[model samples]
Target: GAGVSQTPSNKVTEKGKYVELRCDPISGHTALYWYRQSLGQGPEFLIYFQGTGAADDSGLPNDRFFAVRPEGSVSTLKIQRTERGDSAVYLCASSPEAGGPLFEQYFGPGTRLTVT
Candidate 1:
């Protein structure tokens, strides 16, 4: 895709189920990131991959959350044993590179996860 694309714009799942959200980033973008945005709050970085390796995964809330970009162009965020508090908009963003200066991100519309 020419721009970032996220699947399942809205997802409703059981409180303990597992789910995976997908992201297809813009062509040639080497930096991919995943963030979570709660209502009325800004996106919080969850993980970032530079090329094929995770540059950072500091913001993943717990072991239940994980992400990967094995090929560097497409990524997925997976959640296990979800809880009601896990409901939020999962955003995917991409930039030209991984670090300093030229890293302005372009965002996807996000997948709204609702657990009941």
Candidate 2:
């Protein structure tokens, strides 16, 4: 079974451009998370969706970064203005609801975004 998947393994764009990253989590998983990692640093949590709504969005840097899980399975991460400082690998992970033995999450291969 597919664990978690992301399209466009790499993306390149000019500064000020907009980009949307997609993540398709494993079927039946109810908890999904998004993260961003700059070079030489750990991944920073972005946003999390427990079902059809965002559970914790405090990790989003600003209004420019947003995510949606309208159907409770697939999710999309939207960036308003792409900047060189935003260049990094965007990651997605999925797992069962918290407080369960299956709370361990599985991460997808990150999508590397580059703003030229």
Candidate 3:
């Protein structure tokens, strides 16, 4: 892909349901990240992956949130037992490399998940 792409730009799910959002980062990029943004808040880091391994998952709110980057390319974010408080935008970004002093992340438009 030429740029980051996130699926189901808008999602409406009942509370306690599970949802999966997809992200496709720029081709050849090695670093992938997932973030969450509540209304009027800056994006909050969720997870970061360098290749197939998650370098950081400290920012995930709870065990209900999980993400994976299998090929160091496309990634998926899975949320289980979604709650009304979980309604927000899920964002994805990618950089050419990870663990560098200067790394610029390119972001996807984001998936707006609404828990009704």
lDDT of each: 0.93, 0.91, 0.93
Runs off by more than 4 Å, candidate 1? none
Ranking by TM-score: 3, 1, 2
TM-score, structure 3 vs. true = 0.96
What is the C-alpha lDDT profile of model 1 across 1-116, one tens digit per residue? 47899998999999999999999998999999999999999999899899989989999999999898888799999999999999999999999876676679999999999999
Which parts of model 2 have CA positions greater than 4 angstroms off? 100-102
Candidate 1 vs. true structure, TM-score: 0.95
For candidate 2, the C-alpha RMSD (Å) to the true structure equals 1.2
Clashing pairs in 1: none
* Alpha-carbon TM-score of each model against the true structure: 0.95, 0.95, 0.96
Checking candidate 3 for backbone clashes, the offending pairs are none
Residue 43 CA displacement from its true place in model 2, Å: 0.9
